[model samples]
Target chain A: MTTTIPATTTAAAVPVGAGLSMFDPVFIGIDEFGQPVYLDVVYHNLLAAGEPGGGKSGLVNNICGHGVLCDNTRLVLFDAKLVELGPWRDLADAFVGPDIDYGIDTLRRLLVVATNRYTWLLANRRRKLGPDDGMTVILTVIDELAMYSTVLGSKAQQEEFSTLLRGLVSLGRACGMPVVAATQRPSWDIIPASLRDLFGYRAAFRCTSLNSSNIILGQGWAEQGYTASDIAPTNQGAAYLLAEGGMPRRIKAAYLTDTDIYNIADYAAWTRTPTRTTGLPDMGLAA
Target chain B: MSKSSPRRRFGGKSTGTVTVIEARVHRSSARNAKVAFVLTAIIVGGLAAVVATSYLHPIVALLLGGLIGVTTGAFVWLLVRVWPVIRLLWWWSTEILLAVVLLTGWVQLANHTSTLVTLVVVAVLVGVPAGIPKLRRLVIAWSWCLIVRHRLRVCFAQFIIASQSGSLPLILWATPTPVGERVWVYLRPGLSAKDLEGRLDKIAVTCHASTVLIERASEGNAAYVRFDIKRREVLNARVNSPLVDVIDPSAPASASPLTVPTALDLPDVEVPTVTLPTQAKPAGKKSAPTTTANGSKPAASSADADDDVSDWI
Candidate 1:
């Protein structure tokens, strides 16, 4: 579907509006056979795990880029590194950076929003949120998930963060609040099977070993010859994507440079300003 | 199940009873065998006596029973023999139904109109499919589906290890895909999707496609597999995100504290070059320069390093 840009009502104002919907399929990258791949993030949670500098961050950024452009969408970003998801922080509803307390607070608020949405859904006799529901899609993207779950917090606080994040991941999907998390450490301590299984879509970037790849995709995937370990070190964005298909598929994630990220973030901020006019139709002459 | 004789039973001897007439004719094993021996015998024996009882004369009844039994055996054998052909017709029922409709439509038109109109209708039928790309693609794809079945059978005969009885995997229905084709296969004993995985490259070559992917079709059954033959590579090239286009050309981006990069990259900075230990210097050749990875000044690739003129510090 085409993104509708609302026209500027005043002569002094530049045309600024975002009408992209999150319910639409978000294009991620291309599969091995050149088929463009998309994610239905509204209904699915995505887990991206790989070795350091393996481009899992690139996949996370692509989702953030899309979320910022969508009109009826709210971004909740958690970047312990800050740089990976830093560009779109200005546009985010809540930006959590190296702060466990803030991250936990944001997640709790998200869970509350998710609960209210479910109540509304039940009252409307609907199973899940729809594009027509006019609800904002609160997309929470966490770069370096291990930081919140392992680093920067005490044991109790870390566990709390994990628990709150899990609750949001579980109840948020059907209520227009989906989570996209990425981590370099594909370990049980960082991401247990209980939490990993909650994500319907898993992208395994270049891993150091078969076991690491298995943790990201599943058991037996490496043995079946669909392993991220086989990806070369030089191939930055290469990954094995698992979606609705029972088996994982080889893919290369789309990339955006820092310049591109900043460019998008700036535009999104301007469009999302409280004073930005909306509900106006374009009446200019045909281009 | 098979071509076994009941006379050679669990311990030999039929036990000499009218239980011979009670031997079941295996209707379920029609596809498993070319002939149903016990079934034919049961039909011959059971129906003959029933037909003979209608006659009153003793000698005449005996002759009638012999004739009826022979007739029953012949009919049963004929059905058992032609079972394979019947299965083929059933498999192509869609095409057969289409042909029937077209033929019926032509006849009705001929009854109502002249010969010229019928010829024009036929011409329209031929032209319409040729004119529409979707229809032509569908017809071609379905045609390939038929071709792929034979190709896959040939591949199995050449490479796929058969069961102890020399039975090959049963090739099932195939459908068309955008990149290539997807075919389903039911493997016999001693065959699994794992056995086919290693031989995918060879299968792709045999199918005249670029590549092939084999996956388990059913979770409960390991023998049922699906082959996805790919004729193109979609991810060979790098994909640039659409966010790049969102930038306004006339207006510059306003960066806040969070909008700035972690490490500010100074654009247009000349990269610092260093002398490497592994530099190969010829007697009269110039030395090449090695550069650190700068913001946009990309680190020279290995080949670029080899070709550049180096400056010894």
Candidate 2:
């Protein structure tokens, strides 16, 4: 059942190259019942569903690592879980996380900035600038979007973040920003309806509840009669990519060690900027 | 056998490519307006300070206005008459910060005509050009060396392009095909950790993958591939249900062979062409008892004879 696919861009009616799409590689796979699936052709963002210690990080790492392999795609990781994506910093252009509050706040702000950048780019005409005008694909890979949503405290914060995430997912295709939201606890409360459709490419690892699987991959995938683990020899990083027509591709998870990420940091030494630890340092430092 | 070896396996996920529009015009226009406003404000403030300071200290007033006027004139010259140079210089200039600093210094020097004013004015002059884009980049590099705690690197997205420009090697060792859909797995070497880092580096440089993948392969060369498909738009075709079956790494090889299962339903999914990033150098290493974080034994490897259909997971 292993099928090798060639890369070709058929449709060009609307411009697709101005944004991060130009910088990143798009992944195509198959669903369980032999059908085709695309990663970011028309923007079917990632949906990761698994339980605690259910290989969530391992799976996200594999996908993010593979997804960003395309030279053009840029990974901006928000690892609120601290250790999950922290190791893969080398593979990412910019990484922020472990600071739950700051991370969530930054995600919100980044969405705004990225959206502005995208809209600004779209308004530009070839009469003014060269061909390089396009949105830089910003993959905001959040380790625990569910927890972040819950920690927002008030309903408004949750709704706002949810709405912002939805905006990101809805307008992401045109703007070149895609949200790869991963969570061990998959639930309807965590993932809003706006983003539900956006997560067309759903990947379910080992889940604790059928409800979680149902919320993620529609139905029958997490039922009692059949076990996906039974059919194949699943490893830690491996999971099924669920899409409408995607043919189920049982691919091995990619492994990235800390040393490998360190190598990337070494190369990126030239571009690293000093992080402002003490912002403005109060009026005392200013004086 | 790796679950990928079955006759019905396809690609992994979708390509999240966005249609980006050129925003250079909007950006430049806004930048021009902002720069003009800032410059005007700085000039006006500087002139006012000079006029106001004349009552207190004429020497300080003259120097302050001259300095602010010169900087404004220079910025305007570069931004208007020679925009290309300014555009290029933006990569290395102090830019917005310098202007703001100069305006602030002008105000401070006006209010305080003491030695502090002279020092502040001097600092402004030096900080402007010195804090330019080039200096900014240099400072960034320096800080990275000194202050940056963790590693920072370029992600994989900067390299891969989804265009049909040239026929690069597309190496897909374990791609699954649907019943009627034709699929091709593009292969290049060096996609595994056991592969040579040098070869992987070379291919990554050549292919420009955003992030390279290193999967524990049973047997294969080290080359990364971009999983893409060329779809022939099929209407009303019932899409297949998502795979809910979990993979059991501990399962015996006899349980699942490298052949297509009879009970599985096949959907007519569009097949796309695939491309690989670059090849990696296969490092010499005996099959060590590799344990996953889950403490599971590593999957067995496939011989070169069975490389095509044998799942390398």
Candidate 3:
């Protein structure tokens, strides 16, 4: 489902808003009053900041589980911490962890592939192809984007990631693709100004510092003093949503189980052809 | 745990059962490959013969015949020296593309065909090889088995899970309604066992499954139980028991502790625990099972196994 960006309301529909496919089990919402609530929404990008035990990682899982239900979306996870997203390797399109010497290299490779695809699409004006174009929606999920940006090491790679992310955000919508980069630390260093602007949907679970809240939800959200600990009580999956043309709205993220992720993975994998199905008369080997 | 039990008499049998099914599938796939190989050969050979008679002069025919003989001889030698992949590919090329090669080879062999008798001879030459019984039966069997086996394994895996879990009553497996390349199992979670069973029945009213497995883990609990139900050979088992082990908390130092006093993080309920007997004792002095008098028992041991046997008709 498309993300709704209302023009000028005091509250924006939560980042994970209603009418989204039921990807997660638990969701956080808000009542007419500013109290927290629980409900589910679209498996979009999420950013969670809060004191420890504020359920930052839990929010990450909730978003992932929701995205797992969207068969059209492919999940390529970059989990810097390894522990948070390791158990989910089997269910993702690809995952990067601490063991890999060149995790940044892997990310670069993915970016190259994405760029090449986008280039091809643009050259061919692929938008005209409609359903026949046979494109799969890709979700480049970075669990701790700030940490990864540091691990990337090379200045060129960091800049490249930043540019690639912005390009993906700007161009991904029409292609039914999006980037989901999350970080528990809501500091400006982790959520850079450029990258923050690209994320149309923002969620701050609960912040240890008001600066992080400002970084994620803008000044108004920071004023609310939303805490991660307030998650369940405020609303089970409740988090603030900031988007283009809309005021912040609190919505809950949904909970999903392993089976849900598996089902979607299986479906997504099957929907794509072998990449080299109909043999050509020339018998060109597939790349 | 010691792997010795009197009922281990059935241990060897279980392995054999698994092997038998595995072997059957293996044999079926091989048979299919063999048949396809033969049919492809006959078709290719027949076309080659037709081309040779119609297009090759005496000199060309002799050269072509010599070439074929050399290739055959080389293949026979390669079979003993190389792996199956090389052998199979060579065989497939010889079988399916032989005709095309022969047609192309006419230019190399010498091209001359003017008489009706010559054309008729070519037709007969090709026709006889095409009708060869050895090749035709092999091809048919291989093709049929190849298709059937691929679909069979997929169906079997699903069946095994459904029958084993006894959750078939709550779940249904159906072919894609629109006939896409993908198959899906629609899951309706949060239903009562009966409601789930009703949903399963409604879905299954139009479909059938052979095996089912159900695994459930509570939200706050670390332990999970699984039930396996089988439909084909009659094996249905469930691990209705819970086993728990010590779970060391791993929270980041920067984050709040799990047992935080603030934020009202109290869980309404705690997972029940079971303690295992620590050491063996004298046959007469079976250690008195210690029971916690006031508090929940110490953390349950992490891993446990439940095994069941069934003889389903």
Encode model 3's per-residue lDDT on B94-140: one tens digit a residue: 34585788676554444555566556666776677569986655554
lDDT of 1 by residue, A65-161 (tens): 8888788888888887767887776667777877676777888889888899898999999988888887888899999999777655556777788
Q: In order of the candidates, what TM-score does chain B achieve?
A: 0.52, 0.18, 0.20
TM-score of chain B of 1: 0.52
User: Candidate 2: deviation at residue B146, Å?
Assistant: 68
Backbone clashes in model 1, listed as residue pairs = A33-B234, A34-B234, B287-B309, B287-B310, B288-B309, B288-B310, B289-B310
Output the TM-score of candidate 3.
Answer: 0.35
**What is the Å distance of residue A147 in model 1 from its true position?**
2.5
Q: Pick the candidate with the highest lDDT.
A: 1
DockQ of each: 0.14, 0.02, 0.02
- Return model 2's CA RMSD, one decimal: 32.7
Task: List lDDT for all candidates, in order.
Answer: 0.73, 0.45, 0.43
Mark the 10 consecutive residues where model 2 chain A has the least summed lDDT: A278-287
In model 2, which regions exceed 4 Å deviation? A1-38, A63-74, A88-100, A121-134, A152-156, A208-210, A220-234, A247-249, A268-287, B1-313
Q: Candidate 3's error at A169, in angstroms?
A: 3.9
lDDT of 3 by residue, A1-287 (tens): 12332322112221221222323222333322333343332224445555444445555665554454443445667775655654444445566653222444555556666676668778997652233455655656667776545433334455555666666555554454556667766565655576667666677665545566677776544433232333443333445566433545444444333443333333322322232122111101111
lDDT for position A249 in model 3: 46
User: Which residues of candidate 3, in runs, are more than 4 Å off?
Assistant: A1-46, A99-102, A123-133, A151-167, A223-236, A257-287, B1-313
lDDT of 1 by residue, B4-51 (tens): 566566766553443211122233334334345446656675567666
Q: What is the TM-score of chain A in candidate 2?
A: 0.66
TM-score of each: 0.61, 0.37, 0.35
Query: For model 2, how does the per-residue alpha-carbon lDDT over A180-286 read when each residue is reduced to its tens digit?
Result: 77876556677675667677677766554556656666665444221224222234444555654443343333344544433333222212222112111111100
DockQ, candidate no. 1? 0.14
